[model samples]
Target chain A: MKSLNLQRVFARNTYLISFILLVIVLGINYIVQNNVFELRVLNNNLRTLLPLILLAVGQSIVVIGGGLDLSVGTLVSMLSALLVTWVTPDSTPDQILLAVVLVCAAGMLAGLVNGLVVAYLRLQPMITTYATSFIFSGIALLLLPRPGGSIPRDLSTFYRSPLLDIPLAFYAIALLLLFWSVLRTTRYAQYLYATGSSGAAAYATGVPVRVVRVTTYVWSGLFAALASLTLMLSTGGASQANIGDDMTLDSIVAVVLGGTRLSGGQGGIAGAIIGVMILRVIRNVIFFAAVPTWSQTLVNALIIIAALAGPGLIRLIRRSIGR
Target chain B: MNAQTLRRYLTPPLIALLLAIALFFAGGLINPDFINVTQAINIVRLAAFLGIISAGQTLVIISGGEGIDLSVGAVVTLAAILTFRITGGDNNLIGVGLLASLSAGFIVGLLNGIGIALLHIPPLVMTLGMTGVVSGTILVVTQGEMLGATPALMSTYIAKPLIFGIPGVILIWVALGVVMWLLMERTTYGKHLFAIGVNRTAARLSGVRVERAVIITYTLAGLLAALGGFMLLGFAQTVLLNLGDPYRFPSIAAVVVGGTMLTGGKGSYWGTMSGALVLTLIDSLLRAMGLAEAYQLIVFGGLLVLLIAVYGRELNLRQ
Candidate 1:
């Protein structure tokens, strides 16, 4: 295994490249600032980022199954606003849990609507998700004309606390990756990949393509609900209008960077986690290095292009060598 | 022409525009002044802005290959920003501003074309990515500032009727509609683009420069989008950071609702022209009735669903 081409293995999983990049970027920052791996800064950034990472993971699931759920970002913002506003300051832990469950149920119902529309009415996924974004934002804005919320002291401390001198958010993500990997080996995973890679082929093999496609969205909604909970807690409240706006854009970038094909059927949650980490890390690197805003735009674009270019280059090389 | 062909050509746009008018009048009964002449003139002019943007959107979609420009709004905003910065205070700088705006627009189109055509990137993702870069560039360049103040006298003239009843904007719309019609119906370029869109493999087999067609179509779309942006120079009085934003989705909406197939093969420029006007009327009428922004969105969503139900086949959402 060691001799069977280790570089080839790294080239195949984009997350490894991003992880290496993350290390290099952090190293550069440490060398320059002499922060020497500060836990405080890392925790501070990760708290703001927990919701997005969760959102991206949910998006990755659906994208891998050959569908795009534009509603998850909207769902995150909507559910966060609703849960925060509805869960009053006087609510007990059990009541808060009930409220959280209700939010997840609502998200499930919304996803059910989206799935039915796309499957039964045969609406385009992009348009379907887009229309729901409007519906969700409307409800969100109506619920709170401005940002407001209060997490119980216990919950706030729970999110803010460091478990074993490291951010607890990191631990939750590690657990999520484990769950994602375990699920990857299941029959549902096999069907999902088969469906995304080629729906017609999967259908011929009795994969129940429609059921998997539709169910993926429902589960995505559930994941989004969990994300919203963390997000609201992380922010210590909700903001009016698109609290999760960046998630939609960043999620796509993260999924794509994580080695998932935009066209669908590749990549994993580990890859997506790395993708998010890379983005979050580079942002800090930019600020630390004092890169100008204008140059940063071009640099980010170049990096995204480079990340995508690798797979294309490997394909080109493979074709030449095979011929 | 056969009766079916004639009806097919005329019905969708007619129904769509009529529905919009009906909604506007319904909104008018509630607001009272929405049915008046001044309102009519304003609706027509505003429709022209969306119509120009949709004109470009229609081509990009019609050229097919799943090629849609998400940068339409950003390009327009960038164009607006550049025109303002270059022209600055003097009215004479309008010419220089236009040129500068156009060149910037072309560069955006070039980037989009390279991503989609040369690199074989997915249109939706490529455009989405380009949007981030372009919008970020806008923010970085502008530092969140607006530029260029329009001349008050020119504004009054632009708002007034060019001859007896039609305003300057209506005239531009009419001229654009005619040009688009000719290019689409009577020209070889239009035929070639449609051919490429419907089946690129077949087009390639037939010796069409498929890459060049996709590239040039996107380029043209960009140029036209910039033209729409510059026109706002006189209309909006000053180019703000997001003047181009409102134009983005509405332009695509106009194109889609106007009877263009989303998969790109056959489409109607005249339909898009009416579609643009119809959407503007709905928006303005809603505003007149004192509908809250939230409810306006609700109505907008309902309208889109209603439109799709009526014209599902044309949308190609069936397959």
Candidate 2:
């Protein structure tokens, strides 16, 4: 009975396990490169990781709200395409600012489409987003048929520079966490969790289930737009139609690693951020470990599979032991 | 027939057939040659690849519990590469190549089934992860060098014009479709699949071997996807790095458009056939229209969303 309770507690707090895993990976990364904590390395890594971190945070909300947004990557592409295509070389700061606001709004609008379709039309989230993904990418492709556009170099340089002795990315992370903590205290968050955990029960309990679900996706879209902005900053505002495609899967992996149940109503964004960190650190390990270029993709995939399967295996073992 | 009977007859396939006919005429309006008999053959020939791939997809979807095989595209690619390596364009080694591809698919399907059933991983994540693993493995193994040529026998018989100027692949597709139809509609396994899909615990309580059925269904899907890859090799005569990428989403699109629920359990293979043809016709029409790749993608995506919305909305309302 005691063992069962212990196992149950462990299962209940998967984030704790993820934290340990993150620490272990960081330790390994430090051993590989002793100067990993140097400001330069930290800044470079954090900046590179910011986009995925933001994406995973968005994805966690959707997953927690019992939906999945396959188009998050495409949304990123679309916004980036819009930003670079509109923000020409000689564009004024006001124009750039206006373009940013419009692109973010467009992202929210796109999310509204997804939310409306999935929540109101009652379409399956998986297939619906999958289809819309093409639409988003198609628009992105139309905006920039080829991958040749530039944001202002000064803007990119400014984004790369540190602010007040700390990297800009740290502040961004802090802001996101603050937003999440504030949101968590709201009744809507409780409703969101209730709806995801059991929609029928939540409805019976007078929760506005549909509204909560739709808002979650809308929130996802806003975060996706933010991720796109950070990605553009990191990549010097160059845009590709498929730039965000790869990150879709990576964010999902991060969410799973962070102990967010795909089934819904479990886990949090904090774990998701840690999950992204773990994935990035592992990528760094693979790079520094001198793995062959040909085998790199395969090695990364294998590690992902391991990470995705690990928690499930633990739960299974726990169940068997309990029995 | 009464309205109820008529409505029953107007299944997703029949609806798809009607749409296809309209699209066919629309294509003809764009270019008179599009309505020719040759065009019909071309459409079916193109659809043969999707049909075979989707045959397995339909089964997986029917197995339910949010069952889907996102790895189909990757599996097809891996199978094609492995077959090419095994056969090396040698007709004599074709049998060995087929066996090699099917075995590879079986192993993957088995792993997917085990993970989803015994290990309790979500099908979406499990298959998606499998796609990465399989694609990554292929990249490492091939090192960007895709080998092997289409054997003359396959090209001549299966791909090129044969008896009555019809491709052999279309005939094979018909045969496979019929067999899958019978297997799903006429057999005990079919009933078991539907039951398990409808409700797993209930099915288990009723003494259905749910795990075995799921395992078999996924294994079959994997094998068929590999077979489809072989067909693609025959048609294209050579494989490229992203050869199977095009078929990945379309197969799923076709399956869904054909009336299969994404949530699974209730659908028909016949519906999927028309869905494949409809999707193929759209592709041909888009190409014929001289649309850029971007527009083509937009149309494809938009049409799929429209179809899903049209079908799915009614189901939700009824519920």
Candidate 3:
């Protein structure tokens, strides 16, 4: 009975594999770069990784709620563009605060548009977001036709600075986790899981699945906006239209690696955050391991594919062994 | 035909056709050169590449189970680069290049099929991962070097009018469209595909070789994409990194715009063909209007959303 209970615990812990992978990769990174754990280095790494962590967290919410937001990356680009273009280096504190609010609001509005289309129009979430990505990218390009914008030097320094000898990113991530924990306690979280697992069943149970779906997208948009803000601050407010294009796929990869089923209904933000760390550390390992630049993409691709296929391959082997 | 028959048989492609014509005329309004036959043929010629690629996409999508070929763009780039490298701008080695690129495509597709069908990997994830792998391979092989040019004969075949001022590429596209239509409409394989798309378990229960059919579908998609890439090589006359990047989303868009359900089980090559035309017309019209690239992107995306909203709405729960 105890063994069975342990097995159940192992099975139920969706983050187990991701956590293990993160530890292994982090170990490798530390081995290759001995100073990886230094506060300054850690701060620099976390700052670089914060944007994707935020994006993946948002993606996880959507995935858990039975949808996806392909436009999240482009939405990041659009929001970052808006922030940098509107809030100049000389902008007053009030202006900066107002611009930030408006940018985040715009992101939510975009999400609302995606939500309405997917829920009310009953369109495929993937295609809907794919289409909207172009719109977001277009808007980004229009707002920042060239990659030139500046935030105040002080703001960037503040963003990069350690607080109490710990990275500011650590505090930010802790706040995010706190917010998620509070949100997790709500009934909406249960409804989200149920709706994702089986929308028809949830509907039959009077779950208001459509509204749940819409809210998930809204949450995704909100998080994507936050990610954009982090990215903008990290880059010192330089904006490019296609800045976040590559992050979309990477975000999906992180979500999947985090043990979130791409088909939806399982996993959490913690696993996704860990997944982002694994990805970031993997890059560090490659860099420190002195992998040839030309072959880096190849190596990265192979690792991702291997990681993606690992669970299934393991299951297949287990079944064969059982047989 | 009866109204029901007409709606069933004609409405989707008809919408695409009308949109194409309207966009063409709109371009003409901006610049009369757009209305001429030469320009019209030029649009079709350019669209042939996308139309051909979308043919493969149409099949994969119709095979269902969240099927999509995100690797097509990577495959196209791989094929174009491979062809250029193998042929070395020599007409004598053209056949060798074709054979090599198609085989590469086949292998990639076979792996995709196995991963998705046999291993139960989600199609989107599998293909997306494969895109990364293939693109990475491209980078490794080329090492960021630009090399080789399209052979003279190949360029002429793609660009020059052959029969009554019709480009050879257009004829090739027409022939391919016919083949795709017959394959989808007249073959048992097609029936099995549609059945699998609608419901995989039921199709399996009814004796469809679901795995084989799906594997074959993906393989064919790879072949078609490679073919499109080879033709693109001729059209462009040189290989560039990420040569197929631009074609990726547009191929999927063409399929969707052509009224193919993203959920799969229902669509046609002809609809995709017309959808390709519509997209090409939109491009020409935007260029004719002399809009900046940013504005063009905005208009294009907005119009796509508007079009999809009009015809792509899914059936509600009650239905």
Candidate 4:
């Protein structure tokens, strides 16, 4: 009975597999690099992974709400471009803060555009976001025709530095989790899941499915803004038009690895966060394993494909065995 | 045909045709040199590559289940690289190169089919993952090196006019277009494809081999993408890393602009052909204007959104 109960609990927790995978990968990482858990190393690693972590969190919410945001990465790029262009190294702290607020607003506005088209206009989310990605990338290119910008060294130093021996990234992550927990308790969360699982059913039941869909994109945009800000600070404010282009797919991959259904309404931000960490650690393992430079991409891609196929393959095998 | 039936079949392609012509004249206005017949032939020649690749995309999209082939670009790159390696700029080995490239594409498509159709992986995820795998394979084989060239005869065929100021490549595209039209309109496979796309469960109940049809569609898409890559080698006259990368989104965009529902079950290759021409014209016009890559991206994306807004909206409220 106890074992059955445990099995049920495990089945109930969609992220359990992702969490286990993370633990295994972390262990491999530690074995490959003995000092991986050390404070400074841990902090540095998390710092680098944080931008993607934030992006994945946003992607998770969007996916959970029954939509996808291919434009999130470009939105990050555009925001980063806007940030670097707006705030110079010599700017006052007040100016930097104001720029950050404005950048966040722009990010939300971009999301609103995506949402309105998808929600009211009833366009497919994937294609809509895919189309809009080009616009964001174009804006990014226009803003930073060349990859050049400077943020104050002091700002980056502050971001890198620990307060009370805890990394700032940890605090940011904790705050994000806190925010999610709060949001999850609200009625909006219920509506989001309902809409995602079955929009028609949800609409019949009095849910404002369109509004919920629109809000999901708004949240995604806001998180993307945060991700862009984090990325800019990490890179010392040097901006590139294509800086965030690769992260879009990576974020989706991370979200999936976290056991979140791309079909929506079946996952959490925690799993997505863990998924990002697993991905990062897997890269670390590759680096420490000293795989040939030429074969690294091959190895990485093979591993990812295996991971993506694993769940389906397992189910197939189990069913065949039962037969 | 009655007006309703004619309108249903013709409206999308008509809009695309009108757009292409408007853009052509618009290009002439931007650059006086762009209005000539020579330039028009050049645009068609260039569009042929995109059209061929999008031919596969059209089949995949029409098969429904949110089908897409992101790996088309990677397959193109792989095929180009493979062709260069096989032919070594020798015309005598061109046939061998074509066979090898097409087989490689077939095998990749087969894998994609098995994953999506049998294993029940989502098409988007399956194809995206396949893209990574294919790209990784390319990197491994090439080791990041630039090597080999197109056969001299092939390059000439692609670059020079063959009959009535039309490049041989354009003729190939025209031939492929006709074959595609016949395949989609007259074959049992095409009927199955449409039925499956429109309603998978219903098709299955009605005795359609949904999996087999989907697998074939994806396989053909892969084959066509490889063909595009082979032609690209001729047009480019040399191999380049990620040669097909530029066509990935454009192929989908062409299919979408051609009035094919991304949701599946309604579209035509003729519409896709016109859509490809429109896209090529947009590129030419933008280039002629001397706009920066940034502005070009802006206009291209803006135009895609505007075009889709014009015709791609879902009629259902619960999307």
Write the residue-wise lDDT of candidate 3 on B188-225 in tens digits. 99999899989999999999999999999999989889
Query: What does the lDDT read for residue A240 in candidate 4?
Result: 94
Task: List runs of model 1 lying over 4 Å from the truth.
Answer: A1-36, A200-205, A293-302, A305-323, B1-14, B145-147, B151-159, B313-319
- Candidate 2 clash pair list: none
Off by over 4 Å in 3: A1-7, B1-6
Show where candidate 2 strays beyond 4 Å.
A318-323, B314-319
Q: Give the per-residue lDDT of model 3 (tens digit) for A1-323.
A: 88567657758998998898889888888899999999999999999899999999999999999898889999999999889888888999999999989988998999999999899988778878988888898899999888988898899999999999999999988988998899889999999999899888888888999999999999889989999999989999987988988899889888888888877778899888988887788778888999999888878777777777877787688679879
Candidate ordering by DockQ (highest first): 4, 3, 2, 1
Best by DockQ: 4
Q: How many pairs in model 3 have backbone atoms within 3 A of each other, for residues 3 or more apart or on separate chains, i.e. clashes?
A: 0
Across all models, the iRMS values in order are 3.5, 2.5, 1.5, 1.7
By TM-score rank, best first, the candidates go 3, 4, 2, 1
The deviation in Å at residue A42 for candidate 3 is: 1.6
Clashing pairs in 1: none
lDDT of each: 0.76, 0.85, 0.88, 0.89
DockQ of the candidate models in sequence: 0.31, 0.57, 0.63, 0.63
Candidate 4's C-alpha runs over 4 A off are A1-11, B1-10
* Per-prediction CA RMSD (Å): 3.6, 2.0, 1.9, 2.2
Higher-DockQ candidate of 1 and 2: 2
State in Å the error of residue A56, model 2: 2.0
Please, what are the lDDT tens digits per residue for candidate 2 over residues B1-319? 9999999888888898788889989999998878888888988899988999888899999899879888889888887887778888889988988898999899888888888887777787788878877888888889998777767887887788787999999999999988988999899999998888888999999999999999888888888888988878888878777778888778888888888887677888888898999989988998988999998989888987888887754243223
